[model samples]
Target: MSALARNRVGQYEVASDLSFGDLSAAVAAGWRDFRAAPLYGLFFAAIFAAAGIGLSYYFYNRGELAWLIAAAAGFPLLAPFAAAGLYEVSRRRLSGDSIGWGPVLGAVKAGDGQLPVMGVIAFVIFAFWVILAHTVFGVFLGQSGLGATPLQTLLTPAGLGMLGVGSAIGGIVALFLFAITVVSLPMLIDREVDFITAIIVSVRVVQLNTFLMLSWAVIIALLAFAAMAPAFVGLLVVLPLLGHATFHLYRRAVR
Candidate 1:
């Protein structure tokens, strides 16, 4: 394959060959980045964890804990935004620049208005996911589970069908979101490009490395869910680790 172009249009060349070794290295580098800037990682991770905890608390108190399944599935949809700061930290570390709160936070503004645009896109997708999830829940469980415990509700035949259908839909939605933003968010942080161009490049990267990138998406989802199982504390470590790792992955996947 020809080398990726570094042209004038702010487009990046996608790497044609990305192996599992590259993924491991990116994760290792992410760990190093986190170690190098534990405070920054911890700070961002704390905010993410707090939000998860807050949502869980809010629903659990209202006797609607079951709805958390949908929220949890959709929650990571917003991760690219939470990762905005972590990407900044990794970028600065790689460039040998000073790592400070001001500069790291300021990196969100580095995209020249594209970051917020991406943020809006992410929020809209999340909103859609939530609404769809609610509809699915209603269609399957409806008032049948009104007085039942969350666990009891999920044990019903209707609940099982809903789970099956909902998982299939959520998986497709998450994969689509992943392909578009996987490289785009970091690309925006690294360069100055409109959201449209960045998304195109990102989707191209995933298309070129479909199996490998899908494996990456699975790893991220699994790790994130496992982290959330521990009262959101694991996110203090997992989110930063994954966030930093993603930036490094973007570095390897894009030129």
Candidate 2:
């Protein structure tokens, strides 16, 4: 809100020279936001968890439970969109605006319908990741055909190789998505910019603070994977935390 916080960039006001202190502050603010609206956080987290559980069940029933590995890796690709409501919660709290389901849920239309556009892009990336993951699985471990069990199959040498390659590819994909959406989603809710400009500004923020942003990305990936391990129940806490923190981070990183 101050002139000192503003860093001009080609007609856009952005922030630069971000440090670890900013990350810590953003996360602390995020925790405060979640604490202020526990029910909203819980509701959104539950929806995300249910979707994961359903996907796991679907794959298990189809005897392709091994794909859960790829699913877990690529799953976070969809998180930015899922965190849209959480962003609204944080935004309202930050501005002392009243928080309610109707306003928060309506955030999808906040930026002249850009949020839905981003959502479509998120789903498309996710679908591509899933299909690419299947190809990687086929190329690396299709011959073994899931072994006696999905767990046993993943423990094999071929399975390990597949994991390595798939993880590498997935990480690259996830990072790209992170770079683009890390600030864009919350920006969409906070401003009236089109998705393209939001994305460009998002990438500019990342370029300005590569190390800190990548560190944030790694933290997100680690926590998300850990959260997914216990039947995705941990997401009820982790997702909300990350989502709120992300909005706070966007606030700090962008003007």
Per-residue C-alpha lDDT of model 1 across residues 1-255, encoded as one tens digit per residue: 334452212546678698999999999999999998898888888898899888878887887745777788789888778888999999989999888899888877867889888888888988899889878988887767535466776777887888898999999899999988998998889887888988988888888788999999999999888988888888888889999999999999877
**Which clashing pairs does model 1 show?**
none
lDDT of 1 at 41: 84
For lDDT, the strongest prediction is 2
What stretches of model 1 exceed 4 Å from their correct place?
1-10
lDDT of the candidates, in the order given: 0.85, 0.87
Clashes of each: 0, 0
Task: Give the Å shift of residue 112 in candidate 1.
Answer: 1.2
Off by over 4 Å in 2: 1-7, 149-152
Model 2 TM-score relative to the real fold: 0.93
